[model samples]
Target: SSLTPRPTGGISPIALPVLESLFTGNLQEARKLVFSQMLVSGQAAENGGSNNFIIGKRNQRALQVLSKSVDQDNCKTNALLYGGMHCKDLHRRLESMGYVAKKTEWRTAWSVD
Candidate 1:
Protein backbone atom coordinates (compact mmCIF):
# COMPACT_ATOMS: atom_id res chain seq x y z
CA SER A 1 0.00 0.00 0.00
CA SER A 2 1.10 3.54 -0.68
CA LEU A 3 0.09 6.86 0.76
CA THR A 4 -0.35 9.83 -1.50
CA PRO A 5 -1.14 13.45 -0.74
CA ARG A 6 -3.42 15.39 -3.07
CA PRO A 7 -3.80 19.15 -3.37
CA THR A 8 -6.88 20.30 -1.46
CA GLY A 9 -6.45 24.05 -1.88
CA GLY A 10 -4.22 26.85 -3.17
CA ILE A 11 -0.78 26.97 -1.56
CA SER A 12 0.28 30.62 -1.74
CA PRO A 13 0.56 32.71 1.44
CA ILE A 14 0.45 36.13 -0.26
CA ALA A 15 -3.32 35.97 -0.69
CA LEU A 16 -3.69 37.88 2.59
CA PRO A 17 -3.03 41.27 1.04
CA VAL A 18 -5.27 40.59 -1.93
CA LEU A 19 -8.09 39.44 0.32
CA GLU A 20 -7.61 42.42 2.61
CA SER A 21 -7.81 44.80 -0.32
CA LEU A 22 -10.94 43.09 -1.64
CA PHE A 23 -12.72 43.24 1.71
CA THR A 24 -11.81 46.90 1.98
CA GLY A 25 -13.46 47.82 -1.36
CA ASN A 26 -10.19 48.12 -3.25
CA LEU A 27 -10.57 45.94 -6.32
CA GLN A 28 -7.68 47.53 -8.14
CA GLU A 29 -5.34 46.93 -5.24
CA ALA A 30 -6.41 43.33 -5.00
CA ARG A 31 -5.81 42.73 -8.72
CA LYS A 32 -2.41 44.35 -8.48
CA LEU A 33 -1.51 42.25 -5.48
CA VAL A 34 -2.50 39.04 -7.23
CA PHE A 35 -0.70 40.01 -10.43
CA SER A 36 2.49 40.98 -8.60
CA GLN A 37 2.42 37.82 -6.61
CA MET A 38 1.95 35.85 -9.82
CA LEU A 39 5.03 37.48 -11.31
CA VAL A 40 7.04 36.86 -8.17
CA SER A 41 5.98 33.24 -8.20
CA GLY A 42 7.39 32.92 -11.74
CA GLN A 43 4.04 31.86 -13.06
CA ALA A 44 4.26 34.47 -15.86
CA ALA A 45 0.67 33.83 -16.69
CA GLU A 46 0.77 36.20 -19.65
CA ASN A 47 3.14 33.85 -21.43
CA GLY A 48 1.89 30.61 -22.92
CA GLY A 49 4.58 28.61 -21.14
CA SER A 50 3.18 29.29 -17.70
CA ASN A 51 2.50 26.24 -15.51
CA ASN A 52 -0.75 27.35 -13.90
CA PHE A 53 -2.54 24.47 -15.56
CA ILE A 54 -1.91 22.34 -12.50
CA ILE A 55 -3.16 25.05 -10.22
CA GLY A 56 -6.22 25.54 -12.37
CA LYS A 57 -7.02 21.85 -12.18
CA ARG A 58 -6.61 21.74 -8.42
CA ASN A 59 -8.78 24.80 -7.95
CA GLN A 60 -11.46 23.32 -10.16
CA ARG A 61 -11.65 20.16 -8.12
CA ALA A 62 -11.73 22.12 -4.88
CA LEU A 63 -14.49 24.36 -6.19
CA GLN A 64 -16.56 21.39 -7.31
CA VAL A 65 -16.40 19.92 -3.84
CA LEU A 66 -17.25 23.25 -2.26
CA SER A 67 -20.23 23.79 -4.54
CA LYS A 68 -21.62 20.34 -3.92
CA SER A 69 -21.22 20.68 -0.18
CA VAL A 70 -22.86 24.07 -0.13
CA ASP A 71 -25.87 22.74 -1.96
CA GLN A 72 -26.44 20.16 0.72
CA ASP A 73 -29.29 21.18 2.97
CA ASN A 74 -27.51 19.91 6.06
CA CYS A 75 -24.37 21.89 5.39
CA LYS A 76 -24.51 25.31 7.00
CA THR A 77 -20.98 26.62 6.80
CA ASN A 78 -17.89 25.90 4.75
CA ALA A 79 -14.35 27.14 4.38
CA LEU A 80 -12.19 27.13 1.25
CA LEU A 81 -8.73 27.12 2.76
CA TYR A 82 -6.24 28.18 0.09
CA GLY A 83 -3.13 30.30 -0.21
CA GLY A 84 -3.24 34.02 -1.01
CA MET A 85 -2.20 33.67 -4.64
CA HIS A 86 -5.13 31.40 -5.21
CA CYS A 87 -7.58 33.33 -3.05
CA LYS A 88 -8.51 36.13 -5.44
CA ASP A 89 -9.62 33.81 -8.23
CA LEU A 90 -11.25 31.41 -5.86
CA HIS A 91 -13.06 34.30 -4.21
CA ARG A 92 -14.39 35.39 -7.56
CA ARG A 93 -15.65 31.92 -8.38
CA LEU A 94 -17.32 31.65 -5.01
CA GLU A 95 -18.94 35.03 -5.49
CA SER A 96 -20.24 34.06 -8.95
CA MET A 97 -21.81 31.10 -7.24
CA GLY A 98 -23.62 33.52 -4.90
CA TYR A 99 -21.50 33.12 -1.78
CA VAL A 100 -21.13 36.32 0.22
CA ALA A 101 -18.33 36.78 2.69
CA LYS A 102 -19.74 37.54 6.09
CA LYS A 103 -16.50 38.35 7.90
CA THR A 104 -12.82 37.60 8.00
CA GLU A 105 -10.71 36.30 10.88
CA TRP A 106 -6.97 36.20 10.39
CA ARG A 107 -4.56 34.20 12.49
CA THR A 108 -0.83 34.55 12.28
CA ALA A 109 0.51 31.48 10.51
CA TRP A 110 4.02 32.43 11.63
CA SER A 111 5.89 35.39 13.12
CA VAL A 112 9.42 36.53 14.06
CA ASP A 113 10.42 39.39 16.30
Candidate 2:
Protein backbone atom coordinates (compact mmCIF):
# COMPACT_ATOMS: atom_id res chain seq x y z
CA SER A 1 0.00 0.00 0.00
CA SER A 2 1.94 2.95 -1.29
CA LEU A 3 0.86 6.57 -0.99
CA THR A 4 2.08 7.80 -4.33
CA PRO A 5 0.15 7.82 -7.61
CA ARG A 6 -0.01 4.07 -7.51
CA PRO A 7 -3.01 2.17 -6.23
CA THR A 8 -3.16 1.57 -2.45
CA GLY A 9 -6.56 0.05 -2.14
CA GLY A 10 -6.72 3.51 -0.58
CA ILE A 11 -10.18 3.14 0.81
CA SER A 12 -11.65 -0.30 0.97
CA PRO A 13 -9.85 -1.35 4.13
CA ILE A 14 -10.51 1.28 6.73
CA ALA A 15 -13.43 3.38 5.56
CA LEU A 16 -15.25 0.24 4.66
CA PRO A 17 -15.65 -2.93 6.73
CA VAL A 18 -13.36 -4.80 4.38
CA LEU A 19 -10.36 -4.83 6.70
CA GLU A 20 -12.22 -5.43 9.90
CA SER A 21 -14.10 -8.22 8.26
CA LEU A 22 -10.97 -9.83 6.98
CA PHE A 23 -9.07 -9.68 10.27
CA THR A 24 -12.09 -10.99 12.03
CA GLY A 25 -12.21 -14.02 9.74
CA ASN A 26 -14.45 -13.26 6.81
CA LEU A 27 -11.92 -12.48 4.11
CA GLN A 28 -13.90 -14.19 1.40
CA GLU A 29 -16.94 -12.07 2.10
CA ALA A 30 -14.81 -8.95 2.35
CA ARG A 31 -13.41 -9.79 -1.07
CA LYS A 32 -16.91 -9.54 -2.48
CA LEU A 33 -17.39 -6.12 -0.90
CA VAL A 34 -14.05 -4.85 -2.14
CA PHE A 35 -14.18 -6.04 -5.70
CA SER A 36 -13.27 -3.41 -8.29
CA GLN A 37 -12.60 -0.86 -5.54
CA MET A 38 -8.87 -0.46 -6.13
CA LEU A 39 -7.78 3.08 -7.03
CA VAL A 40 -5.25 5.84 -6.36
CA SER A 41 -4.60 6.79 -2.73
CA GLY A 42 -5.47 10.43 -3.31
CA GLN A 43 -8.90 9.57 -4.56
CA ALA A 44 -9.81 7.45 -1.58
CA ALA A 45 -8.21 9.71 1.01
CA GLU A 46 -10.02 12.67 -0.55
CA ASN A 47 -13.30 10.88 0.12
CA GLY A 48 -12.32 10.24 3.78
CA GLY A 49 -11.08 6.75 3.24
CA SER A 50 -7.83 5.13 4.36
CA ASN A 51 -5.84 1.96 3.81
CA ASN A 52 -3.99 2.30 7.10
CA PHE A 53 -5.78 2.23 10.40
CA ILE A 54 -6.70 5.66 11.71
CA ILE A 55 -4.82 6.55 14.91
CA GLY A 56 -7.88 7.21 17.01
CA LYS A 57 -10.11 4.71 15.38
CA ARG A 58 -11.23 1.25 16.35
CA ASN A 59 -9.16 -0.20 13.57
CA GLN A 60 -6.02 0.82 15.38
CA ARG A 61 -7.19 -0.95 18.48
CA ALA A 62 -8.03 -3.97 16.42
CA LEU A 63 -4.58 -4.09 14.92
CA GLN A 64 -2.93 -3.69 18.28
CA VAL A 65 -4.94 -6.45 19.83
CA LEU A 66 -4.38 -8.74 16.90
CA SER A 67 -0.64 -8.14 16.85
CA LYS A 68 -0.43 -9.33 20.42
CA SER A 69 -2.67 -12.31 19.96
CA VAL A 70 -0.64 -13.86 17.19
CA ASP A 71 2.92 -15.10 17.32
CA GLN A 72 5.11 -12.95 15.10
CA ASP A 73 7.68 -15.62 14.31
CA ASN A 74 5.14 -18.00 12.94
CA CYS A 75 2.81 -15.59 11.24
CA LYS A 76 3.31 -13.29 8.31
CA THR A 77 -0.14 -11.88 8.83
CA ASN A 78 0.92 -10.75 12.28
CA ALA A 79 3.83 -8.83 10.83
CA LEU A 80 1.54 -7.08 8.39
CA LEU A 81 -0.97 -6.34 11.12
CA TYR A 82 1.70 -4.78 13.28
CA GLY A 83 1.31 -1.03 13.40
CA GLY A 84 4.44 -0.31 15.38
CA MET A 85 6.99 2.49 15.42
CA HIS A 86 9.92 0.50 14.08
CA CYS A 87 10.50 0.03 10.40
CA LYS A 88 13.72 -1.93 10.81
CA ASP A 89 11.96 -4.47 12.96
CA LEU A 90 9.27 -4.87 10.36
CA HIS A 91 11.82 -5.15 7.61
CA ARG A 92 13.67 -7.88 9.48
CA ARG A 93 10.44 -9.73 9.88
CA LEU A 94 9.59 -9.59 6.21
CA GLU A 95 13.05 -10.76 5.30
CA SER A 96 12.66 -13.74 7.55
CA MET A 97 9.50 -14.70 5.75
CA GLY A 98 10.99 -14.57 2.29
CA TYR A 99 8.87 -11.52 1.46
CA VAL A 100 9.65 -7.90 1.01
CA ALA A 101 7.57 -4.94 2.08
CA LYS A 102 7.94 -1.99 -0.21
CA LYS A 103 7.40 1.41 1.30
CA THR A 104 6.35 4.43 -0.72
CA GLU A 105 6.40 7.53 1.46
CA TRP A 106 2.78 7.15 2.53
CA ARG A 107 2.03 3.49 1.98
CA THR A 108 3.37 -0.06 2.12
CA ALA A 109 2.77 -3.18 0.09
CA TRP A 110 4.22 -6.68 0.26
CA SER A 111 5.99 -8.36 -2.58
CA VAL A 112 4.95 -11.85 -3.47
CA ASP A 113 6.83 -14.58 -1.63
Best candidate, lDDT: 1
Can you write out model 1's per-residue Cα lDDT over 25-64, one digit (the tens) per residue?
Answer: 8888887787767666664443233445556667789999
Every candidate's lDDT = 0.66, 0.48
For model 2, where is the 10-residue window of minimal lDDT?
1-10
User: Per-residue lDDT for 26-99 in model 2, tens only?
Assistant: 87767755653454344455444343334334444544565555655445454344333334444554466565
For all predicted structures, in order, the TM-scores are 0.49, 0.21
Worst 10 residues of 1 by lDDT: 1-10
Question: Candidate 1: TM-score?
Answer: 0.49
Model 2: residue 62 alpha-carbon error in angstroms: 11
